[model samples]
Target: PGQVDFYARFSPSPLSMKQFLDFGSVNACEKTSFMFLRRELPVRLANIMKEISLLPDNLLRTPSVQLVQSWYIQSLQELLDFKDKSAEDAKTIYEFTDTVIRIRNRHNDVIPTMAQGVTEYKESFGVDPVTSQNVQYFLDRFYMSRISIRMLLNQHSLLFGGKGSPSYRKHIGSINPNCDVVEVIKDGYENARRLCDLYYVNSPELELEELNAVSPGQTIQVVYVPSHLYHMVFELFKNAMRAT
Candidate 1:
């Protein structure tokens, strides 16, 4: 019941407007179709649980059956704890409040809705033959729910981070003139290389090529979020390094 409620509440909306940009080219057909699959799973699960909860109490009162109920409660509590930790961490990192708050608010909705349903499920059905038989099935759905949440959060992060990052860095640079753009990029690249080295301890040493599009007798200067750029480039480098 807890797993079912969690996935159902976190499921994708039918009217979701997610778009994929083709970073490599302008061809729409070449771009990947990225949409959260299994969005309707929650509704289906809610229905299944609704039916199962109607079973007789005699069938659900067994000692072994009660173990499943305890497991579901523990799982729900863990999920609630995770959401609380995320909220607290975001509060500690207020520099990116605007972007983080948006993600946090979405979580706030999901956490409560899932919590409410889990509470109701606990009250209605503690453990029964239907749930015991289907617990493994719903466990897989819970795993999928976590993965879906991660992908959704990543998409929102990239969007909000890009939107707010320029102003964020500018505000920082104004307070500290020593924050040089080229130097920052260089340091970011170095950090990424170190991370790659740590990850691939015995692999071939990875080399990153820095390219600049320069016109004759001109220098290029661009200002952006160093951390975000570092993450983007680091992911690319990590994949390339692994491919080798």
Candidate 2:
């Protein structure tokens, strides 16, 4: 009954990069952001849970898959419990921030967990192209939502002193108005190179001469989340290294 009621009231809103940047300040906008996340997270989690539930029985039975489902269920329940609380009071906001932090920490293993599940499924039943495509689609959406959820949570937590204070100028929560793309790429390459070297005897060096040209002097800056760009670049580098 509670689940049904909660879903009825809150539908997930379309969150875009522009919208996130626009509200990336530590002012009255934060309250609106907090309230939006407070309402939106549970609905997103519920949708993820529903999609996971619809996966094939064999896949669902995988231990990692089960664990992921349990995490989602637990997170959803926690958010639902806090659903009606007003974000108006400092105490309530602080408590909610704590809850967000807890939930964020709990989902840290989500990527590897889902990957393990896919490995287990493939090992047992072999790959069915149609089924694989469906699973891939689900995973893509799931991770995208996870990214958005974490961004929202981190933005709120940063604004509310969950971590060190958000940057006073040019930063709204995690979004950096002048994020340097080349610097992020270098960071990603270094990280990926470190792992590659550890796993393989010969790791290819990343050549970023072109990127470095415009990197200095903040010549190429975008209104974006640096960590998100780093994640994408890291994966690309990792894949390229593996192929090399």
Candidate 3:
């Protein structure tokens, strides 16, 4: 019920939102082997079915809308595929949840780049400044929609993916100055340097170790979103790492 409620809150349209709550409306309801299982099964399964049934309606929509719809379609397909094949074991469930998080991460990595590319294309080819500005209205709406999707996926990954889930790591760590901010910070630094080298031709040394470590008297753990913190720190590292 909680999961279904979350979906309702995150759903794009309040009018169609009830489609997620009403399991009886799911198409091909005859496919389930037992009537009881169909009725008693997790509401999440029904929600996935609902999403699968509705996504096709967006096919003729704008390119950005289509991209988001396609992603949801594929993500739900993966969930269904995993549910059908797994034995409901802990390991199997973990792997399925991991795959879902990976899908969300991939979208996070791709969509921003896509938004930027589209924006750049419009500016480069637009006839006039006003025209480019006008086009930005639609682009802004498109990206806002994508951002909402990401936020929901991120929340879902954390709430349901459990302790071992990568999404859970985002909110359990503390500042690196403590020497115990976990290995993600180390990897983040390396990736930041690599990115700087690729773009700036000269990479600067990331003296992360020299930064003030959290004192023992202070709190050892800081609760926050890992991706948000990492991105900000990584960008700062890139700028500081650059050679003057």
Per-candidate TM-scores read 0.27, 0.84, 0.42
Off by over 4 Å in 2: 1-11, 26-30, 165-170, 203-205, 209-218
Give a tens-digit lDDT track for model 3, residues 1-244.
3434444343343212233223223341222212222122223333443443343232223365456446655654555454455343566555655765776775764456545545545544544667456446545655555544454444435544554445334332211222334445666788887887788776766454423365644434443445556766777676677644
Error of 2 at 41 (Å): 0.9
lDDT of 1 by residue, 26-143 (tens): 3322012111212232343343344334534543353433443443343333333333233335442233324333433444344244334444555666766776556545545644
Model 2, residue 45: what's the lDDT?
A: 79
Q: Quantify all predictions' global Cα lDDT against the true fold.
A: 0.42, 0.79, 0.47
Q: Candidate 1 overall Cα lDDT vs. reference?
A: 0.42
Q: How accurate locally is residue 13 in candidate 1, as Cα lDDT from 0 to 100?
A: 49
Q: What is the lDDT of residue 19 in candidate 1?
A: 30
Q: After superposition, how far is residue 157 of candidate 3 from its true place, in Å?
A: 3.1
- The lDDT ranking, best first, is 2, 3, 1
Error of 1 at 93 (Å): 21
Candidate 2 has its poorest 10 consecutive residues by lDDT at 210-219
The alpha-carbon lDDT assigned to residue 190 of candidate 2 equals: 92
